[model samples]
Target chain A: MNDPNFQNDDLLDIHNLKTYFFTREGVVRAVDGVDFKVKVGEIFGLVGESGCGKSVTSLSILRLVNPPGRVVDGSILFQGRNLLELTDAEMRQVRGNRISMIFQQPLPSLDPIRPIGDQIVEALLVHKKMDQRQAWKHAVDLLNLVGIPDASRRSHSYPFELSGGMAQRAMIAIALSCEPELLIADEPTTALDVTIQAQILELLCDLRSRLGMAIILITHDLGVVAEMADWVSVMYAGRVVEEASVNSLFEEPLHPYTRGLIESIPVLDQDRKRLNAIPGVVCDCINMPAGCKFAPRCKVQIEKNMTICNKHEPHLLEVSPNHKVRCWLYEEFSH
Target chain B: MRHTQCNDGQSNLKESTNHILVEIHNLVKYFPVRSGLFQKITAYVKAVDGVSFNIKDGETLGLVGESGCGKTTVGRSILRLTRATSGEILYDGKDILKAKSSDLKSFRRNMQIIFQDPYSSLDPRLQIGESVGLPLYVHGMKNAKQRQEIVVAMLEKVGLKAQHLNHYPYEFSGGQLQRIGIARALTLNPKFIVCDEPVSALDVSIQAQILNLLSDLQEEFGLTYLFIAHNLSVVKHFSDRVAVMYLGKIIELADRDEIYKNHLHPYTQALMSAIPHPNPHRNRQKRIILTGDVPSPLNPPAGCHFHTRCPVVMDVCNQGEPEFKEMSPGHWVACWKVS
Candidate 1:
């Protein structure tokens, strides 16, 4: 079936994507009807707190959702092809060859027993059909591209021997060894120190410009999103509550949840006695509340007495140019 | 060259208020790195290498650095959780490092700590009430009823309800678990607390709540905090003064505003620039991206530990360790080029 929300220019288009975890307790709607699009060469940021389904959505795109956790509905269209329709064998061709992913913790993602060089060579060998010697040389080049000093010497070292920053760089090298069209970096810098994080971010931006690859940068950090993302989608309770250009999202955050999240982060310049914290805890994914999932924790809902927010679910609607919000307040502004 | 002269102004100011609650002088903590079956100590990982700082009464002193930079070690060493190799930790004039077992017990009553990860820190088997009241119980609060009352009150202070007391650690979320951790830390009514990356593991919104809660508690109880975190922005927000550590040593120390406004040390400047500002438009300044990871503490680079990565490195920086001298009234820096 053709997805109504599909766009021809989109490198990755996700429409009504619902990924749920089937547990004995109940179905946990992890990525509950989420929608977003990533244009070619654009850095699309999927930002949210832990358990908000940002990672699940990324996994869904790659069709990496393991059993018990499956994408129940939605079309993940990539370059006119539906990723969900592709069989496991068919999907293998698309995995590392066309799309690649880097995880938060680099050490565990890499094989500790194998030399870093062999791992990158293995990725090249599996996907690129390169000989062992050619793959080894390509691995060294990839390592050098990621700014790993003395690439040849360092490639011989195991994952355990490398520092956090070096390991992350090596992970990036492996992710980019095939020169994939899209790179999904899941909290790539979250595990590193501030200085190292800066270095890694610079490297990613540099790699993007040089490699001309579209990226889906998934992180919990708003700051990282602002620095790197061209467009951003803020996820809450497994849905895109707000989607806009990076500047618009930061300046005029439409959703109350989005506003709270932006205000919650303590910036280096601002000095306030207390941060504007969103009241109440995140709603349970297993037995989610009806209507707006954020209504229970929303200050606007409480103050405005928006009873409809608790009764009817709000649809993501475009309120302005390139800005969309899934909120009852903007229900009137919907097209 | 000794930079003792730099502290003259600080010493005079110290006498006027005499509010220096915790004064760490020449503090050093080294962990032995062993190898082979014999387990002979080959080298020492200089965790807290001759670090010195003063935490005033009723003020939050932020200690920030990358992981493995020994920020946690400093906090742990000060609390005597892990004994310091050598140092003078003066808590209101009495040296805590030299305190006897009896004295240390009393010291424990006055000092408390909140760990980073709420998941592993609290025991899953224990009920929330028992964990919160554990400090009180250990401190000779023999009455279970009184302990329960204190735990309930503390939980309320941290924005948790009385109903939460009966729940296990597994039942609560990360934010709620953090609140329980804070409640436990405050249960003893300690004068000083070490909050080690309390909000780092939490979400942004939850971090705000916990930070506000910490500030409110500080106001109510007049608690002094050594807030240790790697997040520079959070440190700037929550701390009265901040210390930037690199390679097991505090490279810079100054008032929060002073440090943020005019950082003398190159390492400090790089760290400030490294923080990805939430507002993209505001971050037009060219970020000073430092190269390479922090050198291993076991065999740190000779001279200034940061010399290898410093954008403005000099020959002298690689030759000898720079003295941590006060550049301004309250701003202290350890760099040869700063002067």
Candidate 2:
């Protein structure tokens, strides 16, 4: 079951991770019981639509959950050690050294007043314990590695001086400066143009191959998951509804939600009047349902037979050798 | 007025004439830069410099470019949301750019616009019903009850409920707010719409719902649209014809299939090459990584605006500006090397 390429040489093993935001109305369960393992040289995709708790999950891994939100349950094991159990001091040591994350929006993520090169150097010196002279050189090298031309001169330029694409490239350089074992990229290409998006993805892919780093790519883009992910976890309302290999998930999506998402993508070849969009909006997390999270918007399921789906919550059941689904359809067939 | 694109002079032309609904002739919108205590106009940001295209009666024309490419300006200028410096905006053979207040108001009823961010577009204080019915109130169409009914109907059309009409912008999701925005634009029964990155702010799953709704609404209403966005995948699906703009000018405009299949312009080619296909197995060509940023609109290149980034840049590109000419029957491109 374990191929060298998709090895379980656990770099990051998240177990029953839950992040909930405490609001006056109710507790918004952002990421509930998401369990996944990232190997040393594999790409794991945490994909879902907006408000599906993908970004929250990434933030949780870094121990950066804000005031309203807290990690209510579960363990984040990095290199066989539990990160949740670690003190703030130890967690800081692990943050940029063991795990680094690149934000979706590069403009705001960067220091506006400071030069981008200085940002990279600061991250390097603070995390890697490098000297000022050595860190500056490393920062310029990192910028060059990210395909930024005139790296030395451009490094001196402020964040505002660089274009949108350049700012993104600079952010990538900063994220990869420490050469962390695990890199968490949250919608890295979301704000970029198509060409620039492709370039950034290619660069990430190239870096992954070169460094042999484990990556947890969080995005709403199914196409990106298809291209880069070895294993896919489709999140819906703070829970992984379906988890499978990229091929299996694409070829035969067991979860109705997964199928709807795939069908909704507008193909260049198809000359259709309208796309097969999944009707209804995503369920509000503040007032989440008791049963299956997707039960309210589910179109194909028979309401009468959806008693279990509406009343009782379903756990991830192994339907195939590797494929697992949280839907009631798999439960009846598996039994 | 109905079919002006099909010129009678061309003997090779087989398709019927009068398919064009909106024809722009040398459309230029330059924003003056005021400086100093005297407020002297030093320079101008040529936002939409000599940009032109034709939108068919019922087909959505996708206008795509980077952030500063003047795509949204073209849309605003068409609807007369922003006054153009100079150029002709022909709508049904009448110059709408020079239209009087009454005539412009009539033109506004025929053409509407949907903004990018629904939250900012909609007033948080006003309820959805009031926002949607504001156009009707402005036009003096019906009484409050009648306006409410129309708002409800429009809300239903965008896949929303009448019960939610009393809710404000903050009460709804990004997708829901966008639907409200669409409802607001359509309340006046406009024949044409400028959807300025309508679904860019929504989630991927919600994006599908909005796109599907737009397609359905377009079919039902027989509405023409100018879909402006940076997302190439959405553009490919939504538009019948696509135009690639750069530095305030269109470099390439062609039929959907033709552009995707056999792209001619360097910028269009680079843009198309950049879109990552769903299937990773298919080996894509090396991306034409354009060096340097988009040139400032205030000081564009002397000749070809794209010359700085063009992979196959020539001496002629730096010498003089290339003439925008029709390369094929339905395909038009502006490049020194094309002719």
Candidate 3:
């Protein structure tokens, strides 16, 4: 998304965003010093394993962080407006109007008590100035747009009554009811079968092109990111360890964590036995490493015995054009 | 520095004689959907409707299908965990479906299941030790000290320590719990195991670790598996032979390479193409995207079950069921359009 043509079209600019949870035990730095930019109509991939704060970053952007968890520092700039400075009412105007999220589990996120069409109409009525009949008609149209067959008939069904794929489509319909400028899809297809996942991914890409909405796709599956994202930001332990264009990231990943994460997956195209798994478990965030958060499980750091990786944390620096890495190994290239 | 699949997860290594370990013939399991008063049977769910496959000795047979496609039921029926409506499940040349209770216990010891849901599969109230050790106690491993020693040894085999014996299910991560489940399944040294989506619930990093561990254990123990899952890549990377199921029927079955390189069935092609390749260059538009949902199993479309969504459907496909013919040696497909 850093292409010269889109250089001035940064839709969402997040600078040093730090979200922390002050639990009873201690202050958990769930999202510490994260920085990225999502340009207009560009897909920004935020990838990590579970508990890596990918979801938390999305929550922070929506200002959904509740008590005991707060955005402690930094600013989130959306379309020349600093969202952090806005009051709750002002932020509400943006939430679900300008931006919306599609959760992992559609059944739980969707209102089970009411018909899915009503849910979409509710969002429409709130954002779009339309009567109930018009909203209901628009809701059915949204459902049809999301590829739910026989939308008019299916719209009357409750969340639980619909199949997993249909429920996901309904959720997408609701998310699209407002025609959001930015859609944060957090593992939108994780619970779906491969065929259904393909359908949903196709729908997302089609919607992006048609509506020209920027998407922040948060997922653990590299395959999905490879197919969908234009730029990728690989997260490790609440920090963006690497960010690069899709081709550059895959071709020459600089960060050890990013390489390990990519290598660990069993690729469909490749016929290789025994993956290069990142040894040791994900580091405990409460007692995070003093240096690189990924140092303990990092093969390169351990192999080279880079003392700095254990003693001092490294900051993300541009190593190649449009490619940023946070590792001492690439410190020379950064300078 | 991990050579083990525990990094994510393998295929091939079916080198022992092609002796069939377990054989299933016309396996049919139908759950009667009842309604109204007196619990009158309205219609059958047709869960594992007329499905069949053979697992060769020490060879992995991957059973791949979407949810509610009768893959789990097929696994359950073979193990006798759930009784089949009508089928012939032969274990080591003897039909176990006809086995008496006394003899059935022996068959149960020979075959076990590693469930999909790591959390719900194991009893929450029981310590992992007790949960893993329960099978040993059931099979008459009476001495408590001996059971503990065996449990400890098995736990260590799966990369866990003896100290984790007393920890409950809640204390362990998903990968560790799967490991524990594997250890328990292997305690009796079962010749065959049904891995029901064992790695589906875990994270990507942990999934690799568990997969590698499963492969390593299979080689070491010479265990045959009916690996059931919907993840095509995982299945292809695992089983020596892959069987693709659709609407309670095996649409295709072939060697690992044959299935990927030379699949004939339209359904299989759609399925293989649908798997989001890790590489992006293969555009999504190139896939054979099948329209419409999988028809309900309760009343599967007559003729070819996949005809409703087949890209190259024929008039004959809607007339009668296509024979599961041998298109090539060892490669099976059930589609008239394959010709």
lDDT of 2 by residue, A1-335 (tens): 12245344888889999999998888999999998878788899888988889999999999999979999999988887888998999899888877899889999999999999899998888887899999999999999999999999999999988877889899989889988888999999888877677778888889999989988999888888877888889999999999988878888899989998888887665666677777778887888888899988887666455677788888898899879999988787666
DockQ order of candidates, top first:
1, 3, 2
lDDT of 3 at B146: 82
| Candidate 2 clashes between residue pairs 3 or more apart in a chain or in different chains | B2-B18, B3-B18
Q: Tell me the TM-score of each prediction against the true structure.
A: 0.96, 0.93, 0.95
Candidate 1 backbone overlaps, count = 0
Show where candidate 2 strays beyond 4 Å: A1-8, A303-305, B1-19, B283-289
lDDT of 3 by residue, B83-111 (tens): 89998999999998899989998998989
Candidate 2, residues B1-339: lDDT per residue as tens digits?
111222232212213334677999999999999999999999999999998788877788999998899999999999988999999999978899889988888888888999999889999999989899999899887689888888888899888999998888889888899999999998887778999999889876788889988988876666789999987778989998999899999999998999889888988888876665555444244667666678899999989999988899999999899988898998999998887
lDDT of 3 at A296: 89
Off by over 4 Å in 3: A1-7, B1-16
Cα displacement (angstroms), candidate 2, residue A271, comes to 2.6
Q: Give the TM-score (0 to 1) of chain B in model 3.
A: 0.94
Q: Per-residue lDDT of A1-335 in model 3, one digit per residue for the tens? A: 12244347889999999999999988899999999999999999999999899999999999999979999999998887888998888888889889999999999999889999999999888888899999989998999899998989988999988988889999999888888889999999999888888889989999999999999999999989988999999998999999999888888888998888888888766787887777778777788989999998888887888899999999899987889998889888755
Q: What lDDT does candidate 1 reach at residue B156?
A: 87
* Clashing pairs counted in every model: 0, 2, 9
For candidate 2, what is the interface RMSD?
Answer: 2.1
The candidates' DockQ values read: 0.81, 0.55, 0.60
